[model samples]
Target chain A: MKVTGAVKTGQRPRGIETSKDGKFVYVAVGDDDTIEIIDAATLQVAGKLPSGEDPEQFAIDSGDKYLYVANENSALLTIIDLATRQKVGQVAVGIEPEGVAISPDARIVVCTSETTSMAHFIDVEGRKVVGNLLLGARPRSAAFKADGSELWVTSEVGGGLSIVDPAARKTKQVVKFAIPGLRGEEIQPVGINLTHDGKLGFVHLGPANRVAVVDGISHEVLKYLLVGQRVWHGAFTPDEKYLLVANGASNDISVIDVAAQKVIKSIQVGEMPWGIAIAPTRDR
Target chain B: MRLGIVVLCVAVGWCGVSFGEPSQQLKIGYMWMKPSKIRVSLLDVPADNDGLAGAQLAIDDNATTGQFLNLGFDLVDREVSKGEDPTEAVKELADEGVGMIVTSLDAERLLAVASAAMAHGQLILNAVAIDERLRAEDCRGNVIHVAPSRTMLSDGLTQYLTWKNWKRWLLVVGSHDNDKLFADALRRSAAKFGAKIVDEREFKDTGGARRTDSGIVEVQRQMPLLTQGAPEHDVVVAADESEVFAGYLPFRTFVPRPVVGSAGLVPGTWNAAFDQWGAVQLQNRFVIKFHRPMSTLDMQVWTAVRMVGEASVRTGSADVAKLVDYIKSPEFSVAAFKGQKLTLRDWDMQLRQPILLFDGRNTVSVSPQHGYLHQYSSLDTLGTDRPSSKCKLN
Candidate 1:
């Protein structure tokens, strides 16, 4: 709705997430192979953390004890200890690993590899990969269900969404998308979001310029909300009233009214925006 | 620290279970002729591993994905020496049990090799030789074209020029036969795109020292004299495949008109300056491995190798017939960081992709420009469409 101060990080900053208290924001600077920590109060880069080769996406655990980063070039999921600011463990998954999601219980972590087209399940406590489930080609993002019962992974090139049973380590179902005029290759599913109640899902269709609203329980397509070009990722507001999507090519963010399922505003942003994270509101 | 135990678990069997089947070896052949011609500019010189390096990179890319599929890829590159028979070299590759081949051969040699490979049920991916007839009158069922055709390149450039309202062109032709052929393509494209060639001239090759230390001063003086006295035109289009004069036409033109064709704002499948559509990642990988920028031939060969990898992944087999069948099918599409999936035309077996119009330092724009529409794909507007194709693949 309005302009805000911006902080410049290293080249090609991709994934961003806030700490539990929202005091610091960790960003995976992909080209720099490091994470830039931005202090919330100052809105400036405070420090840097050692990330593995070409870190694309990372997830912070619920307990705020550890950070799981998907090293895209190294094919390893690097675990970093928050308190000590040290590399704690590494689990070899698949090639071009990206799209990290830590389960609600903080016991399981899902790492999706782009080239290998597999979602690897890691035992956070054991510091090892427990299971692997192959999905569509070029898997880009992973999101766990509200209760951590299922995992949804977006396959950018495969143009589908895969729902996996984390406990059984099997793909339970796959939801495919199709638009009337667009070709199959244009329907690439990139970033996925699920409602807190687990009743609705929003799948970002890259290049197709539309966000698919799905019936989360039945996994059926509800409607397609038209948005900006090359939508990469999205984030829900702290109140869940709006969903803000970063359009990479358009260099803008489209704000959609979650309840109405329509675009309400388009806020201009920097060039080729990839990821978005909304921190909780603080008292003045 | 539990690093040792956790690493051992993954190293031994924990993560290994994710891979399916035992690794099956997929061997591919890369046949190329050593670059024989010297360029006018040192920057235009071809590297020793020009085409082969791209195939090697693709092999590594394939192996990365192959690791999860329990597949292993190996590239066996063979350089054909002077007076060596390319057909025999292809047979040698077949003897080594390599059924898929990516080649950077001339049109004649490629046809002979394709004929020889047909007996062994091998598929040939043509990574060089942009002769339009190869995709038209000389089309073969076993040969798939990765490089853009001459007409495609001409059309790509012409579309952009037309979009800019530069309809009048002063066409310059070189004396060599290859240059003449490219000039024909430019003429065809100009006619198809409704652009008029206001004037045409030929620069005869008189056999002189054009690459000397003082050649720049001579070219700068001679270019303006040569380009002068032409009819009214918005651009100068030079077709000089022999590298005789096109490079000199830019910035030295008499009328200060922009240049296009083999010179300024050239149309190509890939350019060193192109970094959009996830191409920077590829460029970084290539530069890190080869210590050089990826050339157009390298990108074409890379696309060819990646096509084979994609087919194998989709069909789940290394059988030559299966791979060829899947690649020729309509459902087959391979991504080469081109912003879209490239598919083969059923009639010509030419890969459909957007051509980048690039200068020496930057990619100015991509062709198949907006407002150029087609019933099926806008990419069809670049070259011979399905209805007008002379190819009838068996």
Candidate 2:
């Protein structure tokens, strides 16, 4: 079955978030600062709710009942009720919020802004920016460990993944990628992935077209993998035996055998598959 | 409890995985279409090194401002044999310190090659594959394409068709299966371009011989009857990829309508008769390479390789990641075959390139006229759009 459905809000919709039960997909339409909801089964667009100003990215709260969208131009985070797809509250963040991540408490949100080069730690309950810590240049994507200990943020301009400790509101480690080969410049990461075991972390190195697999604890580059032209996202199969990589440049998706660390087969799909989220979480 | 603690520790501290610092190598590898020994037809007909011999070409032409300083313009080539494992080859290239790879293969091989590249932080460059699926559903971070997508090419053809007001077509297909597939693509293109297929005809493969006994008389007798009265049509599009009777079409048509498809205005990456702006230089270089003319395959590969050289020079850093970024960004454009600079699409990794609408003798008009509108660019005007698109890259 195709995981297909899109909700066009005001304009320029970029990112999406799915409810835990897989019933709805919340689309972040940046220009209008609106979150549109769609029914996953019927591919029907349902309702539209207010996001903050110029929302860029959003994340799901731990309970899966609240959605937090990071609004860039307005420097705020809009919290919404999952069931109603309605805005419940908004918190002031640092300037130019780009990525959002919900804390383990389900009552706090962490946002990264490009202009300020810092992450604003917010208390969800009070709708306030509780803390601010500087990061790198143009932080774009963010992810959290399964257990929610540390948050990973990718700095597109800085060409690295910045690890932020949520509890302490501090920067942990910065993992950078290689500069471009033929096209010069640093490789800016767009997406982040972690093995089911959570021992391995992979960063989607854009234009670099590789995945930086790092050892989470030691912060070492375990391997740099060439996936495809503009490699974007990857997801593990239910058994965790295969890792499927979306090769943006070539119009193919590679099925990687995890144990062998080799590509078994490449299935051709529709044009340019971008972001991915694997359902029914599996274990190692 | 101890085992759980160890697992937690491993997960918590897994970030310490590095192969030391990177060396300055503009590392690039090749992922060819055919896995075994193969041949690619060139528009320059038998050019060497894809027809760059006479051109003032430099492997390090892209090198600029003291970058790729460790190893300038490192291009490693590996022929992809059908049975040979592409991933293993990618790993081998990585071992040789190649940071990026370029391929002229289908979407299937592109992704396989990409996985291998990812295993070693190597990037893959898709130079020839034009399947739209790769751009939409299979877009990869480590892999970026440098070739015009099939959609782009089709769209190019459709625009000219639309402009020509070739409102009606008699789509004729050869006996070969691939011919039918090409016809299918034409059908899609026709619908997209607002053209109508009055009727579809299939020419069967009889034998090597065309019933030669009294055949000339019979051909004169039947040729007119076969075509003259085909409903209502403005063009007879033949998909005779197998070198069938479509070649005898144009004048032989009963109705005397224009013939297109493979026999008429063909859409392709490059054509030998083309001598646009930089084409003459490219053609000359290719001729010098093989003592003959350039072929479509030769020209495409040559263009793909040259693109790497150009991006390297422009980016001023030969780092594999940086080079890929430059190519992926809208900022990086290459002056290629269709008399314009092309870039990658934001929605799809498909290269937004100009398609040469050729008639085998001379160049026709390039599809993306200046005024075409698209969110990305007029180049996107070639293939399926978001509305008619079936691809959902999730």
What is the lDDT for A202 in model 2? 76
lDDT of 1 by residue, B1-394 (tens): 3576456655674554444443577899999988855776678898998988899999988876676567778898988876999988888899999999999999999999989998999999999989988998899999999998998899999999999999999999999999999999999999999999999989888986786789889888988988899989999999999988888898999999998997888899998888876577788778989999999999999999999988887777777788888999987877777766688888899998889999989999988887787767778898888889999887
Query: What's the fnat for candidate 2, on a 0 to 1 scale?
Result: 0.00
| Regions more than 4 Å wrong, model 1 | A92-95, A126-134, A167-174, A183-185, A281-284, B1-22
Q: Can you list the residue pairs that collide in candidate 1?
A: none
Docking class of 2: incorrect
DockQ of each: 0.35, 0.01
> What CAPRI-style quality would you assign to candidate 1?
acceptable
Q: Per-chain TM-score of chain B, candidate 1?
A: 0.95
| lDDT per residue (tens digit) for residues B44-129 in model 2 | 13333442321123242222211212225555677667777677787778788777666767677778887666667766667667
Error of 1 at A130 (Å): 4.9
